[model samples]
Target: MIASVTNAATLESAFNAFNEQSALLESSYRELQQQVASLTARLDEAQSARHRELLAKERLSEQLANTLEALPGAVVVLDCHGVISECNAEAARLLNQPLLDRPWSEVAKREFAPVDNADGELQLHDGRVLSLQRRRLGRDLGEILLLTDVSETRRMTEMLARQQRLSAIGEMTARLAHQIRTPLASALLYASQMSPGDCSDASPGGKVVARLRELDRMVADMLQFASGSNQDDEGIDVALLLADVAETGSLPMEAASRVAVNIADSNLRIAGNRGALKGALLNLLDNALIASGDEGRVDLGAWRDADRICLTVSDNGCGIPENELGRVFEPFFTTRPQGTGLGLAVVRSVVDAHQGEVVLESGSQGTTVSLCLPAAAIPSAQRAPERGFCHA
Candidate 1:
């Protein structure tokens, strides 16, 4: 009976210990559940924030795309190889073709002839003008070109300039009238004396005729200056044009022989009015000859440089005075008593029409006049025509 009693007590004690262990395990499980719930809540908030960020990014991207499309200028995105990758509607219109995956050269690159140093523009084959700019991709993925149509701007500017020039010309014409009257009076007086029946003094009839011819030349020059190039539609070979210059450039063949012609490309040519060009060059050559006086040699050369044909006339003579150099190109300004002062002015006008530049450099050693003419629409074997240039 005592043994049975002891066994029952032992079992009770064991049950009690088991109950205590179960209670501790239940408490730990509760803490673990709380921790897991907190972590899940934090994760949910993070996911919500991430979703909102993604939506904002998508909206920003859409806005940027819309802005680029709506811009007035043409936007062309080019690949690293300079190939067109994407373009806006304006770009398509300006290029007049699909530009994707095409090389840059396929696009028109002809620049509009600039009126001054500040104007920047390009010309299309159809004669439209555009202003262009470029932006490089940040990581060097490619480039973005922005082109704006500037034809209307240019046209307005030219019209205004034309009006101003007309006003100036009108004033100059009045002065020219006075100049003409004096010469006409002198020629008439000379002609009256040398008439066939009423001859007086020892002045030969040839003198009267020469005076008349001088008047004719002056009229012709004025007419040419007033109306530049009757029609600049003819294309003339550079080589042949130089040969013509050698013939018409007032220097005697022996004096002309002293002019050395230097040009590497024979096939180069220019589109222009040949007669007007010859007349302009003749004036330059005559001036150079007079400066050289009958002794020193004048060097004339034409050569290709990049996209331009450089025609240069150099004289080893008493150079123009430094103070007077600035006035060399001014109309009606001359150092020679018999000079009308329109020679260089005519040269500049012709070059301006051809979209070229005239540069004059002088010092005690000599004077050099350089004409930079843009190469013709012809290929790179290329270039132009100028008055002082001659061929052997």
Candidate 2:
């Protein structure tokens, strides 16, 4: 009996130890199941966030597309490979095609060169001119294109250049007048003293004398137009100039008198060759009056801002068309049947001599001419004298 109890006690101890180990294993399995569930929950949350992010990205992409499409200037989105991914309305109009997925090469082939910016001017196949610009987003985002029509700008630039050229010619003519005037005048005076009968009917001397007389008259007229030395360089009140122009042109007296003169301030003064300025202003005024015909209005005005003074002459005349505006200032270029075409040319020369600039703005309603001049420097030792008066 004693041996049997010992064996049973040993077996009971073994069974208890086995039971503890099994319970420990069950506890470990439960803990593992909880950890697995937590891991699964975290994975689902990440997936959900990712899906939300994708949807938000899609919405943002749509918004960006709509924004780009609505831009006024030409908008083009290029890929990293320089291929066009999308284009806006303006771009389509400029390229003359709806380039949804077309490559940049295809559009470029149609005469639009890739420019660094849209500020540069371009000529199209259909004779249309445009200015192009590009904005690079980043190395990965490619570029955006903006196109603006610059036909008007180009026209104005051409006109300015022509005016400059004419001004140069006028200067040359002035110099020529001085050089040739004395000799021609002497020749004509001597020729005139001798009657036509003094020389043989077909004498070369007689013919030469007649020609010299003609040349003398031409030189005098040229001298009158070309030499600004005769003009007094002094500070003059702008109001006087405008008033003189209005009165002299009879713009205020005409039955249809639609012209008005304005001066920003009575104290506004400019240091310039008065005669030359007057002549220039008068020429411009005459053109404006003529352009207005018998019924339109002309406006003469002056204003000062900072260190610059601007004189403006505007007229409700037949406006210059876009294409013809460029050639208007060109020497001998005239749109009218009897236009000398030298009026604006001479005006530009005078302005340039005064170290000033002339700008033209024309549209359907009328044309405006603006003359911008730099303020005169005050003498370090002398206070500027008061503005003087002129006949205008």
Candidate 3:
């Protein structure tokens, strides 16, 4: 009986150990199940995040495509062989032709024949101007071309430049007029001292004095222009105007016996400053007198010709050299050492302001200058009263 009990005790110990191991195995299996469930949840979250990221990428790509399509500037993609791969609507419109799958060389030849650089300006046959630029996509992808229409912009820039030049010229003219007016007025004042009195209808001597007074008035008018105030916006009597100019601008009575004035005495009125017209005519007469040597005859005529008032001055004196004729109207150009070189330039400026034209003809025998004024372009101001006292 003692042996049987020892054996039963050993068996009992083995059974207990076996029961403990079974419980441990059950606990381990439960922990493993929990771990697997946690791993599965994490995997699902990762997959959902990846799906959301994919949708965001797709939206971004769509937006980029839409933005590129709506762009106004031309956009073109070129392949490694310089062939166009794709282009936007703007590219076709700007080039005025289809641009897809075309070689860049062919496109350039058709559109920009003289093009030598990738980034440059293209002047189309139809007068459109374009600024072209390029971008390298990558070592393998080739290039991207961008073109912008610059035709209107370039035209505006040129117009602005012309306006700037005109403004500069006006400023210079004002300054020059001011500098010359003082001496001219002083000289006229002294000349008037000789012919002291005025006549109603103007005496032979009185008319000469009247004409001198006109010179004084012209100085005032020029001063007004220099001071930036518009002067002489009135119609002038062409006949009386010519009479005063011819009388005062001629040589002294004794020395001018050989000089003949051939201008018509019509009372036809035209738009202009009386004093300014007198000044211009006086300049022409003085030049004529100089060109005609002592006792040489000069002819002056004025008439209407085909929508214009034409004035002519001819002198039978040494003619200007043919090559030098073109430069006569340029400022500070003269063959005479004593000449100011500004007479013809001033005349040109005045004629240009009136929208008129000038023509000069010369040969070995004589020179003829023609001044043509448009019949219209009158000032908006009312007609000025008869040329009486030319003061404020």
Best by the TM-score measure? 1
Candidate 2 lDDT tens digits, 273-389 = 876777678777777877877788788888877887888999988788899887776556778775556667667767887788899999989999988877655554545344433
Better of 1 and 3 by TM-score: 1
Query: After best superposition, candidate 2 residue 295: deviation in angstroms?
Result: 1.2
- Range of the 10 consecutive residues with the lowest summed lDDT in candidate 1: 108-117
lDDT of each: 0.73, 0.73, 0.69
Model 2 spans > 4 angstroms off: 1-232, 251-256, 376-392
RMSD of 1: 16.2
Tens-digit lDDT track of model 1 for 1-392 = 99999999999999999999898888889988999999899999999999999999999989988988899988999889899999888788777675788887666442234333355667665667878898899676989899998888888997688657745765675568567767777776777666676343334664565456556555546556666545486776666766667655533444655555655666666677777766666667667877887777666666777888766778888899987998887667799898887778778877787778888999888888887777666655443333343355
Better lDDT candidate (1, 3): 1
Q: What is the lDDT of candidate 2?
A: 0.73
